[model samples]
Target chain A: MKARVFVTLKNGVLDPQGKAIANALHGLGFAGVGDVRQGKVIDIELAERDEARARATLKEMCEKLLANTVIEKYEIELQA
Target chain B: MKSAVIVFPASNCDRDAATALKQLTGQTPHMVWHRDSELPQVDLVVLPGGFSYGDYLRCGAMASQSAIMRAIKAHADRGGAVLGICNGFQVLTEAHLLPGALMRNANLQFVCRPVALEVNETQSAFTRKYEHGQRVVFPVAHGDGNYFADDETLNRLEGEGRVALRYAPGQNPNGSARDIAGILNQKRNVLGLMPHPERVVDPLLGGTDGIKLFQGLLETLS
Candidate 1:
C-alpha cells in the first residue's frame, strides 16, 4: 500500500511561506486569487494494504514527525 | 564544575558554546552527541543553536525527538541546569520542555542581527549576574523566533517571573510578545532564549555583553 500525508499550518496560525508565495503570484500578474495557503504532501510506501492500519500509522507519524502539532495539522490517505 | 554541550548533527554553534563554557569556567565541557542515550554527569547542559535535522518538519521539531533529548529530559527532571539558545530554544519548545512555540517573524523573513535585550527577571540561576531591567546586546539569526503561547500561559509566565529577558525598547526584531527574548521553566533551572549570547562573548567580537551570561552559569555551578 501507499499513503499520502498532507500537512498544513492550522487556520488561525500564520503561514509566512504561504503569504510570501501569494505575494509572488500577485506580482506575476495573476488576478482574482482570493487566497493562497501552502502545504506539503509526503508519500510513503508500506508493506501492508490495510487502509485502517495505514491511517493509524500515518497519524502517529504526523504526531511524531510529519507535522508539528503546535502550529500545523495533518490528514492521511491510503491507496491500494 | 562539570558541563556538557549537546551536539546535534547540524548544530553549527556547538564549538562556540563549548568555547564560551571553557573560557568562562576553565573546565572543558563534554560534547555529547545527539545519538547518545546518556549525558555526561554535569551541573550544566547546553543546547546550542543551528539547523538541527536540517530544520525539517519545522525548526527544532525533528531534533526534539532524537535519542539524546530523552536523556536531556531525564537530566532536567533531576534538576540539572539546561540552557538552550536559538535553535536549541525551538527544540526545547518542541520537546514540550517549555510552554509556547516559535513562529516565523511577523515580517515573514529571516532576521540576523544584533538586538538589545533587557533582563526581565534576575532571580533565575541564568540571570543572577544581571540586575532586573539591565540591557544587553546579542545576535539573533533565525526565521522563527516569535514565541507564542496561550493567554493563560503568558499570564502565568509573567506572574511567576519566568520571563527572564525581553527585547528592549524599539528592538522588536522578531515581533515577539512584549518583545520577549528569553524565558525560564517554572522551576527556573531550564532556560530557553533565542539570542546568540555565545556570539557576543568576546570583546573583540564587537561586544562583551554575553560574557556575563556565561559567567553567571559558571558562578552558579561553582
Candidate 2:
C-alpha cells in the first residue's frame, strides 16, 4: 500500500512563501492568480497490507511527526 | 552557577552559549548531547540556536522530539530555569513548553541584524537585572522568528505580564505579534526568544547588554 499526505498551514495562518510565489508569478506576467497557499506533500510506501491499518498509521505519523497540529493540517490518502 | 547547554545535531550556538555562561558563572557549562536521556545537576539549561535536524518538517520540530527533551521538561516542571534562543525558541513551541509558533519571516527572507528590544517586564528571573522599559540591543539571526499565537493566548500573555521583551517601537524585524521578542512561561522559569543574547554578552563583541540576562538568573538562584 502507498499513502500520500499533504501538510498545509491552517487557515488564517500567514503564508509568506506562498505570497512571494504569487508576486513572482505576477512579475512574470501571469495575472489573475488568486491567493496562493503553500503546502508540502509526503509520499509514503508502506508495507502494511491492510487498508485500514495503513490509514491508521498515516494518521499516527501526521499527529506524531509529519504535521504540527498547532499550525498545520494534514490529509491522508491511501492507495492499494 | 552550574549550567548545561543542550547540543542537538547542527546546533551551532551551543559553544557561544557555553562561553557566555562560563563567563558569568566561572564554570564551563556542561555540553549535553540531544540523545542523552539524563541531564547533569545544573542551575540553568539552555537550548541554543542552530538548524537542528536541518530544520526539517518545521524548525525545531524534530529536535523537540529528541530523547533529551523529556529530561528538560522534567527540569522545567520542577521550576528550574530554562532558556531557548532562536531555533531553541521554535523547539520550545513545538514541544508545547511555550505558547505560539514561529512562522517564516513576513518578508520571506532570513533576517540577521542587530535589533533593539524593550524590556517589557523585569519581574521574571530572566529579566530582573534590567529595568522595565529599558532598551537593549541584541542580534537576531533566523529565517523563522515571526511569533504567532491565537488572540486569546496573546491577551492572556499580555494580561499576565508573561511577555518579557518586545522589539522597540517601529523596530519589529520579524512581524512577531505585538512585537514580542521574548516570553516567559506561566512559572516564569522558562524563556524563549529569537535574539541571540549569548552572542552579545561580551563588551568586545560590541555590547554587553546581554550579560545581565545570565547574571540575573545567577542572582535569582543564589
Candidate 3:
C-alpha cells in the first residue's frame, strides 16, 4: 500500500510562509488569491497489504512525526 | 553545578554552552551526542542552538526523536534541570517537554539582534538570580522565534507563573505571542527560550547579562 499525507497549519494558527506566498502571488497580479495557506504533502510506500493496517500505521506516523498537532493538522490517504 | 550539553548534528552552540558552563559553574560539561542513549549523571542538561538535522520537515522535529531524547525526557521527568535555547527550544517543544510551538517570524524574515527581555518569573531555577521584572539584553538569532499557544494554555502558563521571560516593551523582535521569550515547564524544571544567553555570558563577549541565569541554576541545582 502507498500512503499520502497532507499537513497544514491549523486555521487559527499564524502562518508567515503562507502569508508570504499570498503576497508574492498578489505581487504577480494574481489578485484573486485570498487567504492563501500552504501545506506539505508526503508520500510513503508500505509493504502492508491490509488497507486498515496501512491506514492505522500512517495515522501513527502522522501523529508521531508528520504533524505537530499544536499548530498543524494532518490528513492521511491510503492506496492499496 | 555539574552539567551536560547535548550535541545534535549541526548544533553550533554546544561549544559556547560548554564554555559558559565552564566559566559559570567551574566544571566541564559532558558533550553527549544525539545517538547516545545514556545520559551521564548531572544536575542540568543544556540543549544549545543551531540548525539541527538541517531543520528538515520542521525545525527540531527530526532531532526531537533522537535516541538521547528518551534519557533527556527521563531527566526532566525526574525534575532535573533542562535548558533548551534557540533551536534547542524548538526541540523541547517538538518533544512535548514544553508546550507551544515556534512559528516563522511574522515578518517572514530572520531576526538577529540583542533583544531586551524582562524576567517575568524569577521563581524557577533558570531565572531566580534575576530580579522579577528586571530587564536584560540577550542576543537572539533565528528565523522561527515567534511563539504561539492556545488561549487556554496561555492563561494557564500565566496563572501558574510558568512564563519566565518576556520581550521588553517595543522589543519584540520576532513577534512572539504575548512577547514571551522564555517559558518553564509545569514543574518549572525545564526551560525553553529562543534567545542566546550563552552568547552574552562574558564581559569580553559584548556583555554578561546571562551570567545570572547560569548562576541561578548553579545555586539551585548544586
Candidate 4:
C-alpha cells in the first residue's frame, strides 16, 4: 500500500512563500490572482495491508515528520 | 551558577552561546550532545540556533525528538531554566515546551539585521535586569521567525504577561503577531526568542544590549 500526505499552512497563519509566488505571478503579467497558498505533497510506501493501521501510522508520521503541528496541518490519502 | 548548552548535529551557535555563558557566569558551559539522555546539574540550559538535522523535515521538528530533548523536558519539569534562540525557539515550539509557532518571514526573505525590541514585560528571571518598555537592540537572523498562535492563546499570554519582548516602534522585521519577539513559559523560567542575543554580548562586536538578559539570569541564580 501507498499513501500521500498533503501538508499546508493552517488557515490564518501567514504564508510567505505563497505570498512571494503571488507577487511573481503578478509581475509576470497575470492579473486577478486573488491569493496563493503553498503546500507539500509526500508519498509514502507502506508494508501494512490494513487501511486502519495505515491511517494510524500515517497520522504518527504526519505529527512526527510530515507536518509541523504548530504551523501546518496535514491530510493523508491512502491508495491501493 | 552552572549552565549547559545543548549542541545538535548542525548547531553553529553552540560555541557562541557557550562563550557568552562562560563570559557572563565565569564558568564554562557543558556542551551536551543531542544524544545525551541526561543533562548536567546546572542552573540553566540553552538550546543554541542552527539548522538541526539540516532541518530535514521541518525546522526543529526532528531535533525535538532527539534523545537530549527528553532530558531537557525533564529538566524543565523540575523547574530548571531554559532558553531557546532562533532555531532553538522553533524546537521549543515543536516540542510543546512553549506556545505558538515560528513561521517564515512575511517578506519571504532570510532576515539578518539588528532589530530594536521593546521590553514588553520583564517580570521573569530572564528579563529582570531590564525595565519595562525600554528598547534594546539585538541581531535577528532567521527565515522562519514569525510567531503565530490562536487568539485565545494570545490573549491568555498577554493577560499573564508572558510576552517578554516585542519589536520596537516601526521595526517588525518578521511580521510577528503583536510584534512579539520573545515569550516566557507559564512558570516564567523558560524563554524562547527569535533574536540572537548571544551574538551581541560585546560592544566591540556590535552591541551590548543582550548582555543584560544573560546578566539578569545570573542575578536570578544568586
Candidate 5:
C-alpha cells in the first residue's frame, strides 16, 4: 500500500515562497494569476495491507510530524 | 550556576552558548547530545541556534522530536530555566513549549544584522538585569524569523505580559507580530528568542548588551 500527504500552509498564514513564485510568474508575462500558494506532497510506502489502517497511520504521522497544524493543513490519500 | 547546552546534530551555536555560559558563570556547561535521554543536574538548559536536521520538513521539526526533548520538557515542567535562540526558538514552538510559529521573512530574505530591541518584561528570570523599555542591540540572523500567532493568542500574550522583548520602534526585521523578539512561557521559566545573544557576549564582538541577559540569569538562578 502507499499513501500520499499534501501539506499546505493555512489560508491566513503568509507564504513567502508562494509569493516569490507568483512574482516570478508575473515577470514571465503570465498575467491573470491572481494568487498562488505553494505546497508539498509527500509519498510514503507502507507495508500494511489494510487501506483503513494505512490511512489511520498516515493521519497520525501528519498530526505528529508531517503537518505542524499550527500553520499547516494536510490531506491524506491512500492507495492499495 | 550549572548549565547544559543541548547539541543537535546540525547545531552550530552550541559552542558559542557554552562559551558565553562559562565566561559568565565560571563553569563550562555540559554539552548534552540530542540522543541523550538523561540530563545532568543543572540550573539552566539552552537550545542553541543552528540548522538542526538541516532544517528539513520545517525548521526544528525533526529536532523537536529527538530523545532529549522529553528530558528538556521535564526540566521545563519543573520550573527549570530554558533558553532557546534562533533555530532553538523554532524548536520550542514546534515542541509546543511556546506559542506561535516562525515563518519566513516577509521579504523572503535571510536577514542578518544588529537590531535594537526593547525590553518589555524585566521581572522574568531572564530579563531582570535590564529595566523595562530599555533598548539593546543584538544581532539577528535567520531566514525564518517572522513570528505568527492568532489574534487571540497574541492578545493573551500581551495581556499576560509574556512578551519579553520586541524590536525597537520601526526596527521590525522579520515582520514578527507586535515586533516580538522574544517571549516567555506561562511559567516564565522558558524563553525563546530569535536574536543570537550568545554571539554578542564579548566586547570584541562589538557589543556586550547580550551579556546582561546571561548575567541576569546567573543572578536569579544562583
Candidate 6:
C-alpha cells in the first residue's frame, strides 16, 4: 500500500513563494490566476496491510515531521 | 565558560562559532557531531548556521530530528544556555524549542547582508552586555529567515519581553514579523536568531559589534 500527503501553508500564513509564482504567471499573461499558495506532496510506501493502521501511522508522521502545524496543514490519501 | 558547538553535516558555520567561543572564553569548544546522543557537561551549546541535511523537507527540518537534539533539549530544559544562529534558529523552531517558524524570505530571494538590529531586551543571557535599545549591525545570511507566528503568540512574546532583538525600523532583511531578529525562550535560557553574531566577533573579520554578545554570555554563564 502507498500513502500520499499534501502539505500546504495555513490560510493566515504568508506564502511568499506562492505569491512569487503568481506574479510570474501574471507576467507570462495568465491573468485569470487568483492568489496562489504553494505546497508539497510526499508519497510513502507502507508495509501495513490494514487501512486503519496505515492511516493512524500516516497521521503521526504528519504531526511529527511531514508538516509544521504552526504554519502548515496536511491531508492524507491512501491508495491500493 | 565551557562551550560546545553542535556540528550537523553541512553545517558551514561550526568552525566560525568555535573560533568565536575560543577567542572570547579562552576555552576550546567541543565539536559535537549530530549523530552523538550524549553531551559533555558544558555551560553553553551553540547550534551554528548551515544547510543542515541539505535543507531537505525544510530548512533545519531534518537536523531538528538528529540524535543530538535529544541532548540539546535536555540541556535547555535544565536552563543551560543555547544560542542558535540562522539555520540553527530554524532548527530550534522546528524542534519546538522556540515559537514560530522561519519561512522563505518574503522577497523569495536569499538575503545575505548586514542589517541594523536593536537589542530589544537585554535581560536574557545572550544580550545582557548590550544596553536596551542599542543598535548594532549583524550580517544575516539565509533564505528562510522570515519569521511567522500567530497573533496571540506574537503578542505574548512581545508582552513578556521575550524578543531579545528587533531589526532596526525598516531594516527587516527577510520580513520577519514585528522585525524580530531574535527571541528568547520562556525561561530565557534559549536564544534563536537569524543574524550571524559569531561571524563578526573579531575586528579583522569585519566589525566587532558582535563581540559583546559572546562576552555577555561568558559573563553570565561562567
Best-performing candidate as measured by DockQ:
6
The sequence of per-residue lDDT tens digits that candidate 3 reaches over residues B1-222 is: 889999999999999999999999999999999999999999999999999999999999999999999999999999899999999999999999999999988998898889999999999898988999999999999999999999999999999999999999999988899999999999999999999999999889899999999999999988
Worst 10 residues of 1 chain B by lDDT: B172-181
Looking at model 5, the pairs that clash are none
Candidate 3's iRMSD: 0.7
Question: What class would a CAPRI assessor give candidate 6's docking?
Answer: high
Error of 4 at B3 (Å): 0.6
lDDT of 6 at B63: 96
Residue B146 local lDDT, model 5: 95
lDDT of 2 by residue, B18-75 (tens): 9999888788989999999999998899999999999998999999999999999999
Off by over 4 Å in 1: none
lDDT of candidate 1 over B1-222, digit per residue (tens): 699999997999999999988888899999999999988889999999999989886889988998999999998898889999999999999998998889889888899999988999988778999988999989999989998876788899999999999999999888787788899998899999999888988888889888888888888877
DockQ of model 1 vs. true complex: 0.61
**Lowest lDDT 10-residue stretch of candidate 3 chain B:** B104-113
DockQ per candidate, 2 decimals = 0.61, 0.80, 0.90, 0.77, 0.87, 0.95
True contacts kept of each: 0.62, 0.77, 0.92, 0.92, 0.85, 1.00
Leading candidate by lDDT: 6
Q: What are the chain B TM-scores of all models?
A: 0.98, 0.99, 0.99, 0.98, 0.99, 0.99
DockQ of 2: 0.80
Question: Residues A1-80, candidate 1, lDDT per residue (tens digit)?
Answer: 99888998888777767888889999999997757889999999998777788788888889887787877888888888
Error of model 1, residue B213, in angstroms:
1.6
